[model samples]
Target: MSRRPVHSVRSVTAAAAALAAVGALTAAATPASAHAPVHPRAARHVLLLSVDGLHQADLAWYIARHPHSALARLAGGGVEYTHARTTNPSDSFPGMVGQLTGGDPGTTGVYYDDTYSSALLPAGTTKCAGVKPGAEVDLTEDLDKNQDSLDAGQGLSGLPGSILQMTGNPTTLLDPAKLPVDPKTCRPVYPHSYLRVNTVFEVARTAGLRTAWSDKHAAYDILNGPSGKGIQDLFTPEINSKAVGYAAGADWTKDNAGTEQYDGYKVRAVLNEIDGYDHSRTHKVGTPAVFGMNFQSVSTAQKLPASDGLTGGYQAKGVPGPLLAKNLDFVDQQVGALLTELRTRHLADSTTVILSAKHGQSPTDPTALNRIDDGPLLDGLNAAWKAAHPGAGDLVAHAVDDDAMLIWLTDRSQAAADFAKAYLLARSGTGNGIDGKARPFTASGLQTLYAGTAAARYFHARPGDDRVPDLVGVTQYGVVYTGGKGKIAEHGGAHADDLDVPLVVSGAAAPHGVRVDSPVRTTQIAPTILRLLGLDPRSLDAVRIEHTRTLPAR
Candidate 1:
């Protein structure tokens, strides 16, 4: 069924890779050459799937052991980028944005799914930033994830663990007054408006190609872009709501398998769209030129705590163990189902399948879990800021952390002072500070580390752009800022464990299961999709700026 000629790079020596790079650079000079529309019998569609939190090592090990798994089956005739990595701050928001926009957070204006934005809340809104109407705060999925009680308001379908133990009065983040604001435009931001870059969907739609996508939350509407155009059919059922109160539905109640049920519904949604109909959308249909969905099943297992006969979370390095293995199998089944649908419709040869993930989970070594309390840190920063500006009403607006902490400060100009005060108190104190009294903070050389490397590439922003974080605290490996007792493993860091995501591109004009070791970024997926759809990759502004190139094509 393969139509593209094969080119292998599995054993590419350094010299060979260098030559390929030069070739790629030379070829990329004229990206517009690929704009010819597909012939009548040519592949006209691209299927992109992101299994959130699925690490490359996890996939490699899974494929090797479960030779018959869906990933292995696809790898048989696909181009596997073993060295594919996501952009820094590899949270779902920035990672997915990077894939579809060919830009990092610095370029796309997206930092995390839940981040502080200085833009005014959406029009016709009155709440957010506490009493300060124009302040920056979180506008994440959790805001609208769960509100109504399930089964006649008699359920608990939100927030992991018993919502009873939440600190800082988190319910306030979801309050109508604490809405998210887009700093760039100073408009109250919705999901789509939050995205600062054009997505492949918008590009494809502008070029007259149909597109469809499915993700866990409306926050993913960022993939649709600020204009919110391009997507012919979009399905977002709200996973947090579906998994509210951890209700184990009949379909997927095996340990962490409940997430599979949520993912399964979306997979079915994509399949239905691919079959030329979207009951949720209009009737103008055929297979989309670009279609995809993200699965959170494995992510559920990756964050699962070990308790009550549960051996979940990252088991060893390569071994997914029983819990994760089940989710992996479920993902495989969904992919196989998608493939079967394509074949039955005689569209297999007319479609390109790209199997990948948004980001990888970190702290695979469970023994080194370092849970830090963020309360003291936030309080210290707030005190410092308040002391500097008297009655500033908490200069630290909000703080989000995975293994790394992304803190949003109210006064951007005083960032240095804020950092200095917090650092001094943290260093002199004990407790969580070191002595356990919730010391000011840890001396992780956050500024030093952030400055020593690709700081400009990741943190560079325009002047007066409140979108940039005021202070960033990247905790040491395995050190999460929250002392929360739910998830054992988290992501959002520059660590190899979090950046290394699995990427497999197959079908249509793709090579036959060739292994590519040359370093590639998740950003390549956008340009690659444009190329696959017979569009000039250069048409994308971010791609043009980055001089991005598609993977090898013969």
Candidate 2:
């Protein structure tokens, strides 16, 4: 990640502390709006903005410090959910899936980035009829049938057992060999592959609403392999390989003219689409009714060198920092531009703007800040366990993200499962700087770990999923997962910081300056958007929480 470097540690820390203090004071003093007008007619256009890793608290802080921010301006004129929460294990994939599908892991079947594959292809089959490895299979019908069984823990071994029986095809599971390879390393890349479920774009398109999407990740655009029928146009910096004037082989950089700033490019694309519709460049009516985009530069900036100054350039600038702030500001400016266009074209009153995020980013623990390397903890554990067990099945330990480690035992035996758990517990605190070391668990241990918790409400296992991870390891707060450089920051855990995020609704068609304080989950986003658009949430099995009250029943 290319970012402006910060050179002063002492100054940076002091400045950040000061800024945080001031921000706290400002939040306490600021008065929230008491009431707002609500519009209820079906909206003509819906603009959805997704900012990666945006925290509601951070947003409030940004507004308090920089009242002129686009975010602040929008908030002042819109409704913000003060107490919003995301789904458990709030990782990017699940968060986004929740927004688009309005279903939690239980309903959507997207539990993690690397879930248990149920595909049963013939031996030696590398690809699925030319489809990329790790591609999503259509499991909607199967999921529906086995929902009850899965919830009952009939098949939780993370294998292709019962699910395969339901699907009737053993090779329909996820196969690593089918995952998209990195051009340089020949390894599977992020996102694994496109989703298998019907997303929001598809729903919108089916309703005759034109749509467009701009995201930083290629998988967002590369849905299930190529033909982007759900989305009319997809613009991503990572996949803008064929954009005119773009360097043929250069990597992502500022100099690459074709690679417009992620947010800026998306805003411009949205504005262009609106303009084209207004000028008759495209069909005036039945044109794109929804526009969605993502900005990732802020995440990139966090990984860059801190600037040399009090609070470091990154810390002093705010949560997103200067670079990201500038981009977000630009996004806001473009939002203003779109609003102006809507009003000028007499469309403002009919359009609804919904802003949200995929997940929130937790800052690196200052005490253990620059570590990004994962030691040979897994290897050592496996070596020791294997020496004792002799001919046990292969133990696969994968560091999924910064917070969780998944262990898969290839051989399905009671002895292997018992040994695996004991070994993990013994070596849990061996290498990681975490105070709470890894521990092995039996079926009973899971209950103890989540004693008297809401998490237990949603905990269910399927064949393949349950057996794959006989033992799971968790990192305590401030101890993020490391790949090599040491320990840095990451997500994919069951913590409030990782699961809580902001949900804001702003625009002429929405209720302005109203705040909703309730416990909400990502599964509600899809249904909420649908409801706002005058559609029925029950169509997708998304239950409307009691806290979701429409603006005056307009």
Candidate 3:
């Protein structure tokens, strides 16, 4: 990481106690928005946040219910885009990268937590890296499925370097043993490889801005590039590393915080990073270029697996249950703490705090919760195709099912493609059906869900890119295809419940209490961050491709 001299000139606004006392600021382009004020010096620091699974409706309900929360305070100082939405496959990986890089999964080459890659695993076989179609390098926290390879030589024993950074050198961050390698190609795929574009952090860093970010796992390591190294301080503690909270143990509450244990851990990590120190305060660094963290307690409570904390029923039917509500309150308190920290560090006016969700959970309505298994149907589809072709390989190479299903087909033949599309459409008919049986799959009635979506428009760079999902199926809202234990609500759909999320940008330059009804996508977030810092948003690959606009400021 590059470092400036300790005596480097600091932005007056960053050190100022209030915004009114601050002088005029300037940005890359003069404020071009027909609705924005005259040229103002750009915000100096950015505190981007990803409150995973926070629905637009949920935020409104939360504000309405808890009139005096920090969320309200932040919104009071900024404009919240009521119509902001995550990208198509509204799952965590794609969603986060969508905000960070302004690209859909197709552009990022990432679809879900566990996606199939055409790349083969490394030469030597490892239990974590399966030697097959290859899995997208995502951290689910569990050893088998997560970023165990980036475990700073500690594996699962202690915190992974991806989060804490035990080593001072940022270049050699990950341990080779922890890297995910392709079996056939014998190529080890580092986490950053997942993202196909440079993030705003990288763009900011290249322009001499210090960058930092934290999320649930090191898999977010994707935010690391546009360059070899950008983030000044990166923290990503595995949410699944601890089994006490959600595990059937003595009690998580007894250990201080229940259910919210993971979030609490990240809260501490984020605060530490914000203060320019590592977890242990071993070394001190500068303020930050673009720093942010994600909150998961609310999402965890809403989507708690059956075994986590569900004593009676779902977290809540129409409104949040006690547990979910408490978690929201906890996050709000955390937000307050974050704001206080910013002010304490004299960074209040200069730092833009972006609050939004990576994805939104489904089945917020109990009556809407419905879980279905597409495994049997998918297996049958494979069996039928296998029987017909004999040695043509399985029709379905890999499949990740959320509210939407990303299906990868092994048989790319025209006939097989036609059959698969027909099969999914047949199964996705009225009420989601196959033949005469009702197939509870996808919110969109047709399997051609991707056909008319931006996924097709943007994600499909060229014809038959192996990285592109061959077929996509969206289950009705509240419908899930997997029977994972303890799991309740799920996301990844085109429905409003999964797509619409909060996008609030608040700071000295922001118009207080204003709301932007202008339609915007989460993709605009990266560009907005750049614009906030007086950097050109079009400098980014995806932003240049998407023509993402910056948020309007008064």
lDDT against the true structure, each candidate: 0.64, 0.46, 0.62
Candidate 3, 1-554: lDDT as tens digits:
01112321323233222222222122233322211222244687888888888877777878987777889888877777777789878888888888888777767766777666555443234653444544444334432233323332344444322335433232344444545565644555666765678777777766777766666665566677645476766766545443442336332222214436656656666677678775435667766768878887767677654323433124445577665666677789989998998899888987889999988877677565555666766877787777877776778877777677777666545566667766665553223211123444433333334432323444555456556666766665667555433455678876777787898888856767766554567877876776666666666677655555555432
Clashes of each: 25, 49, 25
Flag regions of model 1 displaced more than 4 Å: 1-42, 119-134, 137-139, 143-187, 242-255, 279-284, 307-309, 385-392, 414-458
lDDT of 1 at 36: 46
Return the lDDT, model 3, position 189: 65
Compare the candidates by lDDT and give the number of the best one. Answer: 1
lDDT of 1 by residue, 405-508 (tens): 67665555554535544553344232232112333334632323332112323466654465666555555666555565656677887677778898887788
Cα error of candidate 2 at position 455, Å: 10
Candidate 3 regions exceeding 4 Å error are 1-40, 119-186, 244-259, 305-318, 427-460
lDDT of 2 by residue, 415-498 (tens): 665665555444433223222333232221111122111122333334444212333444454445564422234566554555
* Descending-TM-score candidate ranking: 1, 3, 2
Task: Determine which window of 10 residues in candidate 1 has minimal summed lDDT.
Answer: 163-172
